[model samples]
Target: MLSQLTYLSFLAVFAGIPLSILVMGSVISRRGDHQPVRVQVGGVALMITLALGYTIPWDSYLIARGVWWYGEGVVTTRLWWMPLGEYLFIVAQTVLVSVWTFQYASVADPTVGHSWRDRLLGVVAGVAVGAVGVGLLLGPAETFYLGAILAWAGPVFALQWGVGLRYLLAIRRRIVVLVGVPVVYLSSIDRIAIAQGLWTISPTYSTGLTVGGLPIEEGLFFLVTSLFIVQALVLLRWVIARWG
Candidate 1:
């Protein structure tokens, strides 16, 4: 039974993830009348930039290592199904989260010129969401990476972008900001993971680490990929409540 299941799992990993993302992404893209070409472009750009940026050095490092022994086939991370499953995961994850949070962008009331009360609400909201989301979906390893994306990214983005608006207001203008941070941080985690084989989308993805009866990849994955979907869901909920 176990062997049969493993075979099926492997088959799904090889066949499933990438295909679904393409379909889902397109469907979601067309849902909004006001959607911009740039959002789609940005997604492409992010995937390319991140994939190239990460894969280049990762391949290089793997090559540099005595033997990468890499090959292409269905690899099961068990979190999702597909070859380069993480890519599809990232893309689908990105779109959903961006769109979801983008929903919150409706709250700003552009005529207001940004309100501190709202900002405080956003911070409180984001933090509350982060904490609660973290609590519901999180565990120890995940607590670190996902937490970083959710809690810290908002403030970090505010500083970098000079976003003087409150959190809710910021969402109103665009929840893309909310989406971007988690995406970037998650992408970073993936890049690092692939390079180190902390977790993998392909059969050959691996690193020489294991702990507490789990692959290092899983531990790292626990920290990274799990919350991506949740963050997207939460942001989307917030956005819909505000906008819809």
Candidate 2:
């Protein structure tokens, strides 16, 4: 059974520790950085706001629809249909990714031009993914979780890609590191949470697929959300550079 303490402990261990270390490192290494602390903080704050606004309603719907649920005593309170802890998770995850993004943000020079070909290719790919998700959503109950994730995230993916796909690709290695580390770490923790009955992904709504005991849908959820944060931050930096 999941207690509120267990949930908070997970956040403390997985998110809190890394965030503390990163902040300390930034404070110590603040010399000669392209972005000032104020700018970095402002960018992160903006991303966090966007993340919460975009995610809360979708997550609430997921809980209400029985796509997932928490263990007994796992959450002590609710905001709309989500636990308070869940909201904190959203903020923590956003900050983690956004901070990591700034750490590696110096690698890419965003002034270089991008071709229309790349933009079209990315948009088409996003549309295709969304189409597949829509099909799954209409097919059967088992794919609802996966479908909802893709359907919700695909358009955002397309928009980001259309705006700055080439720029992102130029900084692909940095983006990979920033996005991959947290996604892998958080997904691992999420796997443990599910295994320990901290929360349950509804079998009826999810495809019966697992990656080393973690649901595939859960993995995809983390992956896309992390990507969203990284993409937005990287592009925002680019915009500021080009026109700020």
Candidate 3:
């Protein structure tokens, strides 16, 4: 019955359940820090809005191109080219990472000051990754999915780096914990969903590569998206600290 769960129900179980628990825990833990909580909550709201706005169009385009598709009876409704469940996923994932990031932000002392060298390094690295993605886009067809993920995510990574590479580096360990846990956990669930026939990735668009039966592209997809959410929340907190 678990594998038989509809796509929406699957998210309700995996994403919704954990989100409710984490949100309650975050609120209880931060109850004493009212101002910071307000700021973080505001930041999370903004990130959620931005995540939905940014992801919907891109995901719809991918679906239209047959990069991926949902299984029969797994989805009950469609919005444009995406299943409604996919939209919920965008919101759920952003909030999940935002709440998790707050756990670190509440206790960690802010890293002050910035360096042009660090900023430049971050920009160069982001651009380099984007370049690689562009190259893959022009190469064999199988690399297209990976290429699209990198290309879509690279510029945002650069922008975040440009704003707070120094700060991000200072809190590197926290970043790892914030981004890593979600990516691995979500990737595992994603593997399960694929196994259950909830959705199928087009072999024509994806690299025919697997990590423990999960596609490498799927892992990278979660990796970059998690990084985007975590980095945004951390930087937003940093900005509020400096200017708010």
**What's the distance in Å from true for residue 79, model 2?**
1.0
Measured over all alpha carbons after superposition, the RMSD of each candidate to the real structure, in angstroms, is 11.2, 2.1, 1.8
- Which candidate gets the maximum TM-score versus the true structure? 3
TM-score preference between candidates 2 and 3, better one: 3
TM-score, predicted candidate 3 vs. hidden true structure: 0.93
Winner on TM-score (1 vs 2): 2
TM-score: model 2 vs. ground truth: 0.92
TM-score of every candidate relative to the true structure:
0.34, 0.92, 0.93
**Better candidate number, 1 or 3, judged by TM-score:** 3
Q: List the residue pairs that clash in candidate 1.
A: 13-82, 17-81, 100-236, 103-239, 104-239, 105-171, 105-172, 119-166, 198-217
For candidate 1, lDDT tens digit of each residue in 84-187? Answer: 44444445444444443433333323333435665555456445644643452345543333333344334422332232334333343244455455445445
Give the clash total for candidate 3. Answer: 0
The digit string of per-residue lDDT tens for model 2 on 1-244 reads 2334466677887789999998788768873287777878898898889889999999999899999998887777788899888999999999988887788666447566677998897798788878888988888999999999998888888889988888888888888887888889889989989988889999999988999899999999999999999898888778777777
Q: Which portions of model 1 miss their true places by more than 4 Å?
A: 1-30, 47-88, 99-109, 112-244
In model 2, what are the clashing residue pairs, if there are any? none
